[model samples]
Target: MYVQIDLDGPAGTLRVSGHGLPVVELVRAPGSPPDAHTPIGSRRRALLTLRVDGVPASIGPARGRLLRRSYRVDARVGGVRYRLMPCGYEHSALSRDGRRIGTLQSSGDGRVVDEWEGAPDPLDLVLGTALAAAFGTGAAPWWETVGDIVGELIP
Candidate 1:
């Protein structure tokens, strides 16, 4: 399954989709605990906590400068402690055993992209993008659409 998260709009407004179907919507209001409904979350935080379907996955601050910064968030999901490292503008999800699980890519225009090798859970992708946004690296142009990038990558 393919998941896409758009964070190009106002802070706390995120649109999430699985393949071509709507899955959830996520919002992070200023000074309030981030809330997600309709499977919606992460379309938007300060030291944001990565929440998927109302569950916190990773906790970290979106620090450093663009292209030169890095996020070392602590992920506690599914009884697993994972590590997320920034790779350029994209981020990778690794198991505690250091195995590659999947990746969350970003367009210069501000859309969060998801790519993985196995049939990884969609929640993992959402969590990855949510963490990226939480750490403030989710930057994409306003006009880029998730549909536009679908089928563009043939891996």
Candidate 2:
């Protein structure tokens, strides 16, 4: 599985490769204090749009859905890992502190997988997340809508 995580937008996109992947470990940050858990899930916030190999868009993924799961990871990397729940993200494959992570995309039924190259910047996590969201939508980010758009992409 592949995943990318942003601290500010608090958003990300991941593409998984197979079924029964160990996704639970991605949530929360690696080695985070147990008191800080994945924010209670919000369906409105978790709405993910998907496209298969450039197929038409779908609100719910065709193969599977990405779920957010909270977990603790190598503290040297970040201390905690708040990963997608049931599905996986690029963050899982990368060191928590690494910048060149990928995204993990899953189908609703958890069948297929796709991991796209990610572009996260070490300076601004929000900007990096917005960039990723734009990539997912195949649309350019409007200069004015950047903050709100970025905020909407993540929780």
Candidate 3:
């Protein structure tokens, strides 16, 4: 399943974090054939608690679920919104595999952050681009259409 999350932070905007502290978003699941590379532990649902720029936002599961090979999540916190989508794929299909959010192309490895350590982070730009693509393509929510000209740093 694809798991995506929008994180609130002092950065002044919505961003994604897998390891900044507190699993603002949890990324894990078991594999078929019981592979040890990935394992499943006792699992249950709990409120998703996060500190957005020091303020806290706890949310109940809203849209996405682990069951879908692909999923999308949109959340609001600290008055800002976050978007997340996770995709599960087979080995053979791994080549050239990526999910498009509007126009920001995300590599399947979930290593999207390091790509934006530089100013005007290309990844973030791409994310906005993805939103624009989706919105313009008429493939996603109408609100995302604003992404075409509006880009934010989440501050």
Models 1 onward score TM values of 0.51, 0.21, 0.29
Task: Indicate which candidate wins on lDDT.
Answer: 1
**How do the candidates rank by lDDT, highest first?**
1, 3, 2
Give the clash count for each candidate: 15, 48, 19
Best model number under TM-score? 1
Deviating ranges (above 4 Å) for candidate 3: 1-47, 59-70, 85-108, 113-155
Model 1 residue 89 distance off true place after TM-score fit, in angstroms: 6.2
Query: How well does candidate 3 match the true structure in TM-score terms?
Result: 0.29
- Residues 1-155, candidate 1: write the lDDT tens digits: 55565763335555556664424444555555443321122222342345555555544433332333234455666576655565443454434436767666543244556666676666556665555444433332323434346647755
Model 2 agreement with the true structure over 1-155: per-residue lDDT tens digits: 23333222133233322232222111222233322112211122224333222332222111212222222111221232212212223232222234434443222222223343554333123222222222221112234346666789996
In candidate 1, residue 96 scores what lDDT? 45
Q: Compute the lDDT of residue 149 as modeled in candidate 3.
A: 32
lDDT of each: 0.48, 0.27, 0.29
